[model samples]
Target: MSPSTYRQYEGVKARRRWITVGLVLLAAAFAIRSAQFGNPLIHVDENFYLLVGDRMLHGALPYVDIWDRKPIGLFVLFAGIRLLGGDGIVQYQVVATLFAAATAFVVARIAAPMAGRIAATVAGIVYLLLLGLVGGSGGQAPVFYNLFVAGAALATLTALTRPERNAWDVRRQGAIAMGLIGLALQVKYTAVFEGLFMGLALMWASWRTSRSPARLAVDMALWIGLALAPTLAAMAWYAAIGHLDAFLYANFLSIGDRSGAEAKELTRRLAKAWKALHIPLFAVMLAALLEPWKRWERGPATFGFALAWLGAAIAGYAVFGTYFDHYALPLFAPLAVTCAPLFTYRPYRFGLVAASLMVLSGAIANAVIVRKSQLKRGHQAEMTAMVNAIRPRLKGCLYVWNGDPLLYHLTGSCLPTRHPFAGHLNLLREHGAVGVDQETEVRRILAGRPSVIVDHEPTPRDFNFAVVAIVKAELKRAYRPVKIVPLKGSRLVVYERVEPK
Candidate 1:
């Protein structure tokens, strides 16, 4: 080989090495930043997931024992964490840190071919920097799903760029890509949309290379079938256990059943957030679209498929109808690659550094502002006090009605009700479905007569106010309020059943 060509190859390898080191550093930074205050379970959702995971570790299946719309793969990760001796919130944060790093590595890999080393590193850095920005903390579904989704995308890109004239090799790669997506599906159903986008891109790329529509169509169908294995296997397990119906409801219908005017509120919140974040990301994506020819003129197929990935990610986020800030995390992967021009374009290379600083600064500001203090001093402090003050008063199971799940774990008591968190049940009530009806839950509460009932009211309709209204009335009749501990954004009132006069 010519010395100049060899030099270029060496240069690529050196850039990759630097990118690898940068990703490792950024990941470490993420871990430190995440633990900056403490474990990153900013939302009660993490607590709930942790609770469910612990329950599953004790042999309880999701939806049957404790109900949530989260896919099985989510609980599986949590259960695995439990087995690994890191079942607490701190352990969850550690796992999330690793996932953030692995995903950034995949982002860099996808970007390296099309956008070169600078863009590649930028992609990785973007992911690492933006993870904490959404405030999902360490254990959000996206934390894990992003890694699986990106790995799947990488596999798809690999399949698309194969130079092997061997058909079996192409099919094998395609199946692997789809299989990774299948595993992603198990993490969260949102991966399906991104999977669909990759599937189409793979088909298009395959048709271009093989020029045999019928053959490719057959193989693609098999690849799709391969993708369904994880989901299908899950269904079979639930079916075997005679809880398939519950499985369907939790994974599919529960989310689908959530309807009504609340969706508008979610959209509005999303819109406000989008305005703040749009400029830097949109500018990069716009560059990708405008310079489509340049993006795919050489290198691997990451650029083209990344466009699909972004579209699919956006479509998934929009159609899901919930606009939680963390929901926006999936957008960063495609945005990073699309932003390649930020580093490659001489006029805009400086903009890359500037935009990153803005993102980092903005994230820090948000974390500081939202955290209300250092992580340790914030909600964790309140919860610690609540556990210490309240655990002594508890004799039996703990009941958190429309309140944080950490209370259950912190208080070290069993769950008193199947319906724990109000996040989903509130939506079900808006459907006018008896599925989350107040009467049933009220009966459970009265029957169990939980030793410590924590009633939290920070926001209207944050709980099933209507049903919780009934539950509260019953608790008032049978129990007396023990303590009201005010915490950030929420206050907890502990109720113990009144002893007979």
Candidate 2:
């Protein structure tokens, strides 16, 4: 081929590559656009995260003023999003969409070498589409943290493929990967299992090139320290502010103290998650059992790494014993990459069929989930009505005892207590799990006499009845039922304090 002709061809190829990436990102945004804004109660966790983040902007500390088991870094991300523009919900959703898209791009990049570009791009799109099926349509913590995990995997994979020219270059890449994992840890601590796997994978790669045990040991220690640095820094900041104990208990100890669901309930949840996620899970198992490396010469190391990452993610999800479908979010990225080769393999056509089923099933499931979520939580009109009803009656702080915590943000009312998340204080599983005693905190919030108290009728089956009893007594003594805003599935009962005549 002529030199100029070859150069022109390469230029066109590069532009097409970029265009494909742009298209993937656009596809991600379109897939999740339905749930982007004006839906405050997309998920209880996100609602509380947004509330905590907005509070932070006004100088409220996380563990000190708003409590949750989630790492502080997640709140910081939301706060940074709020700083960018209007209501925190829309901004965070946009940011999460970007994160989901970026992670998909990385998924494509990782799979391209083994699977053809077309197959790899399909893998990326599949990742985005499946996110909605798993409650990741909005700013779920996994939606944000998965990008960091994918980036770390990409870094590790790159280091694995590169010929050992400079040992330091490989070490540098490992450091960057560990740093990314540390950041992911801040978003959600479950990233630790994945981080540990990636760390060991990097060390294994280092050992291959450098045969010195001492050097490997030093490298391992440095990577572990890097992975812990972000969490330590957060703890140090809390310590400096004299809230270190609060930080430690909420972030670490609280999880252990929490009670687990009954065996039947847990099994039911696990089975449900499996039903929703069976496609990807089955694909992962097929890839492992088939041993794709044996059939494709170029796939041994990459497939091994991807499979191990998927395993680590599954371990993380199962470790807590609570198999909420959203916990499977971290698995999607690695699942997509691991199954990329299936799209192009001609022998069994398993990958192609799986991909088609996943996309089609995921789309229908996502639509139903979004519609139900909107119905159950109410749309913008319903939210506005609830807000308006409570705002005027709120003479002081607002206490969201058993309803959407987003009211705390939308009503522009002060929080009645650090435990703004209703489930943390109301659920049977969290009776003594949160850093503060549930009964004492509820009493304190009641003593403060919040101007408006929001409660939901037909309380959850697992509610802490003792705490509910105290709250009911207080409402009877000092509050009067004012408005009942009917949601699709339930009614939000707003109570205003009785004024002394």
Q: Give all TM-scores, in the order shown.
A: 0.88, 0.93
Off by over 4 Å in 1: 1-19, 22-32, 162-166, 289-301, 352-356, 373-377, 424-436
* CA lDDT for candidate 1: 0.70
Q: Can you write out model 1's per-residue Cα lDDT over 166-272, one digit (the tens) per residue?
A: 56666666777888888889988888898888888678767776789887988789879988988899999999989999989878876555654466677777875
Off by over 4 Å in 2: 1-19, 163-166, 288-297, 347-351, 499-501
Q: For candidate 1, give the lDDT of residue 404.
A: 76
Against the unseen true structure, what C-alpha lDDT does each candidate score? 0.70, 0.84
Find the candidate with the highest lDDT and give its number. 2
lDDT tens readout by residue for model 2, 238-357 = 999899999999999989998999889888888877876788777767767766444555577788788888889989998988888899889899989987877765667766877787
Residue 173 error, candidate 1, Å: 2.5
Query: What residue pairs are clashing in model 1?
Result: none
TM match of model 1 to true structure:
0.88
Scored against the true structure, residue 424 in model 1 reaches a CA lDDT of: 48
Give the per-residue Cα lDDT of candidate 2 at 235.
Answer: 96
